[model samples]
Target: MTGSFLPYGRHVVDDDDISAVAEVLRGDWLTTGPTVEKFEASLAERVGARFAVACSSGTAGLHMATAVAGLSPGDRAVVPPMTFLATANAVRYQGGDVVFSDVDPQTGLLNIDGVQDIVDRARNGIRAVLPVHLAGQTVDMPSLARLAKKAGFVVIEDACHALGTEYLDGNEVVSVGSCRHSTMAVFSFHPVKTIAMGEGGAVTTNDPDVYRKLLEFRNHGMTREANQFQNRDMALDSDAEPNPWYYEMPSIGFNYRASDIHCALAHSQLKKLNSFIARRRELAARYDEQLQYLSPILLPPLRIEGCNPAWHLYAVRIDFKASGMTRKQVMVRLREAGIGSQVHYIPVHLQPYYRRLYGESSLPGATAYYAATLSLPLFPSMSDGDVGRVVDTLAHCLGMN
Candidate 1:
């Protein structure tokens, strides 16, 4: 673990996970089947959600959630500038506009003050607000929920970075996907995420209508239930009875359904979610303690009031301006020493496509934050020695030694 190249993030799959996938493959069903439902049920229960809809990727999950939130053409959703493009792209996927909101430069949190300013300025056209839990740090959902309520827009939590994350409601802890604040909490099961399902994601909601729409949208908008059908008059259905094979497609939808093979691994991983997060927190604490003294690198924010993070990525802002060296130079030095690092984002509004569409808009806080942020290697599988090695090498790169 000391000598091997450390990645910014990685999945931990034990024998149990392998056996689960193998058992599922050996079964009669491989795609949508019992395993998928079991995974969904397990996810829903774990996240405190009333329903969980499995989907192809986090992007697809966000798309479905946005659609459920009424993010259609000519509407707009306010999103922070500092996040993966998928957060805004999902809004565009529904043909809705994305209005950029700035973030807190130090913590990378979507500034609630900035959000309120955007909402107060815009009299109308904003249909939803997406607050991303960047780097596993849960946003202040309670306050954001209040803002959405006042603004008359739906709230959808882009919780891809936050799975085991939770927040205290005075004393009672609320899970991230409980939808206790937002309309729906979306999650990702990518290999690099807190959970690994090869390629999968899910949407968790308490609203039955949103849950129903999520299910229908993921399955090509086709429903087999006769009661939900629009055009009931058909040879397959009659007044007294219905055909077993009859199905209906009322609206356009995508094939965003995740396969059972993926869900098998996800369910297996879900069993160890708490432990995985525990180890990740341990590693992150180790990094924070060791790297705090280094001048060139600002350690990640270890705590937020009322929130408990899942420790997805240990993103530290390198003081490149103070160090008189480029972030690229520090990253190269770390890579040469077998340590991996990454930039969490480059401000979605500045992306090539977004730039073209928005015609060169700027959010100063997100821009300044992006200039210094770098994610150091932090994963559940990393040992204490590995953590020390990373800190030592990073210090050396910054001339702290």
Candidate 2:
């Protein structure tokens, strides 16, 4: 049984998902259709956002937020170091500078002090902040939002890892993508995420004007609404009769539309999101209990109060100095034993692109976290027995005698 390779993450599709896609295949439209609107409305309601815009990918959604938030040339965004490159790269897509913020060394979540550090160090005009919910855990968004408001910069959440994840807002529990504490929040529907849509994403916002901008940008900065037209060519006669095909393209835009087929499948998957989060939490708890005896590896679970994390990945830290083994050696042995594992991240500031752009800088918190972080397999499809096998195999590979 231990010889069966288990991946760190995967999609858990069912017959309903297939049927939904099949129905879409037999329908009239494939790209922009009724299903897309339905999916956006359902998702917006689920996360308590006033509006939602489905897009081709999470990166596109982030770019939409940056564009709608007015990030342009000579603007900067402060982002955490421990995250996927997209979190920072999205700013650059809109011609904005990225300022690196260090995370808490143990939890890998950015904090208020880190924001202060960014303010003190950045020589450019910092206009926005992107707080990443790394490894399915949320930053203190309520506090962070307050800080942003006081500092006069907009906040956008990189909630790609936190779909069903929720946190306390005083007496009420709010979902990460609610946009309750930020200008907007982004979500991904990749197979490895909390929910899968094959390939899709969305941005959620409460601001009507921002939502309108998102709508225009996602579909090539064009609008079919007659009232929104800016050209006299749109008028047919002195009667001011509008052309049914009249549309305006005031600014350059890209094709970032999410197809109806993807939306149909994602809508089906969204129905199971609660159960998926429940199972992931169960697996995470099992790992927490079973791995307590394993030395030199620190397990990170629901460390914060009032956080119901969807647990997109179960990342822990291995103390290589005490284990007397290299990180590469342990990973090799685990792979040989059919137990797959991966590093959650390398410091974003240390990446060659960022390094070349900003030169070298010290970030002790991000460095320490990267030196020890490792992600173990934890998916909704994983059985308790499978988790036991993984723990036993990992123990054996580490030679925990």
Per-candidate Cα lDDT values, in order, are 0.88, 0.87
lDDT of 1: 0.88
What lDDT does model 2 reach?
A: 0.87
Please report how far candidate 1 places residue 390 from its true position, in Å. Answer: 0.4
lDDT of 2 by residue, 133-220 (tens): 9888899999988778777899999999999899998999999999999999999999999888888899999998899889999999
Q: Write the per-residue lDDT of candidate 1 for residues 234-309, one digit (tens) a residue.
A: 6244454677777888777899999989999999999999999999889888888888788435656647888889
Deviation of model 1 at 348, angstroms: 0.7
